[model samples]
Target chain A: MVPLSWYLVVAFMLVGLGAYGMIVKKNLIRILIGAEIMGNGVNLALVAFAVYGGAFSFTAQGLIILVISVAAAHTALALVLMLMYNRRYGTVDLSIVQKEEVA
Target chain B: MNWKVKMMQDLQPVLDLFEQFEFFLIAALVLALAYLALEHKDIVYAVFFFGFMASAVAGFFLLLDAPYIAGMQIAVYTGGISALIIFGVLLLPRAQDSSLETFATGRVRTMGLILSGVIMAISGGLALIFPWPETIPEGVPEQSQSLQGLAEWLWQDHGVYIQIIALIILTTLVGAVALLKMEKAEAMSSITGEFGVEAKPSPEPEAETEVVDTEETSEEAAN
Candidate 1:
């Protein structure tokens, strides 16, 4: 069997990559994508820990069901917000908010 | 007979190493696809890579012997969330100049890189340094391995969490529909005063064609 630490290493790396996406990307959609990635990374870590606990594995599986549904809801709502943002500004450039010309 | 016995002993270690190697490749693929998703310039392709990354995550779950979660990952992430993103893209206004607007400034990006790198290093380093058992401990209740056990654990103890999540999903569904149903004119009405002259498009020139956008939404809203 694969050791526990390896999964953790990968999971954290994923979180890091997702963080990069969320921070550097200008588009709202890309930011959302980054958030999704970060969530997945966390989920992987949780599942790993649960597997290690043995008895907790079942609870974790059930928990993942909750997590996945919540994530789906999260994405849908975020996209709706992005749509609103775009329609208001006529663009999704995101940097538009920084400009002093528009209050 | 001695040589044959030695070969059998050697094969066990190799087989174990092969299992570890297989998992390593999945981990590598997940990270690689994640990197691609982050770095890709085009938003659609970035979403595409993100979808693949999620699928790779599902495969990782399978590696951990959680087949049910893996299937759910594929269904929810690869199927549902990806479709939502694509639809969001479709609903987006087409930009006049699209090439250079996707990334932040170099300084901001560099700062992000440093912060996230520090975070990943701390977390992963902690996990690595912590002494964890090499295998699952013995005498674990056998119920953990079965679906019935998972259901019992979830519903019996954690029903509260499940209920809360369901409520959130319900709210989200309602909110998304409400947001989508709102007209563009209404959405921008508050900001209209600030950008009054710029709001309405003049058909005479190609000017502000970027803001003008598709006639479809306006027409649909009229209906």
Candidate 2:
């Protein structure tokens, strides 16, 4: 069996990448990408636990599906927000657009 | 050298292969695609690469023995979320001028880099320090047999919560349509000669000045 530590490490690395993306990227869509990365990280952790803990039953599967669906729903909302940002500001940059709004 | 020989002797080939190759391969691929999505200049392509990365991650989930989640990942992420992101990208105006310049500079980037460095350091430290459980616990219920039991529990114990989540998703779809519809109406109002009345008034002032100058010429003709 694959060790739980290995999966945990991969999840951590992915989460770190997501954090980096979220911090470094200024574009609204890019930030959404980072957020998706973070969500993937969480999903990885959940699946890892389910497998490692020997809890890979249907309830666990159902919960994982539920989480995935929720994430998809959230992504939809974020995309809508990105569209609104692009429309109102004519630019996707978080900093420039916010500056314009304040001014 | 001796320890390596003993370890190989004890471990199954499948586990060895997973540890040696597949895990790292998927991890590297996911991280690389995520980096590309964030660093790429074009927002449209970033979204596209993100879709690829999400699907790859779903493959990883399958390897981790979570088939249900793998299906959901592909279905909800690659199919639903990615499609929505692409639609949003298409709806944006094609003009790219000034957008790149707005994001490429300033203190925010510097701060973000610093924060990411700190987070990476912390996560790395945690991974190193935490000792993972070596084996699955004994006497735990077998996963395959528990499937029917889980189904019963889900329906009997958590059915209400599942229904609520379904309702929330439905509401979100409705809300997104309503929001987009309002924006379209607003855009139409702004463009269709209704909101540009101020722009026409400046030309009207110039026309009035011309009319005043032509008034004497018309009077001469009348006389």
Candidate of highest lDDT: 1
Model 2: CA > 4 A from native: A57-59, A101-103, B1-11, B94-101, B134-141, B145-157, B183-185, B189-223
lDDT of 2 by residue, B136-215 (tens): 56445445534456567668877976797889799889978876776557766434442243344344678786787699
Candidate 2, residue A53: Cα displacement in angstroms equals: 1.9
For each candidate, give its TM-score against the true structure: 0.78, 0.76
Pairs clashing within candidate 2: none
Query: Model 1 clash tally?
Result: 0
Stretch of 10 with least lDDT, candidate 1 chain B: B93-102
lDDT of every model, 2 decimals = 0.80, 0.72
Model 1, B79-120: lDDT tens digits are 999988988877673421247465588899899999999999
For candidate 1, the iRMS in Å is 2.7
**Best prediction by TM-score:** 1
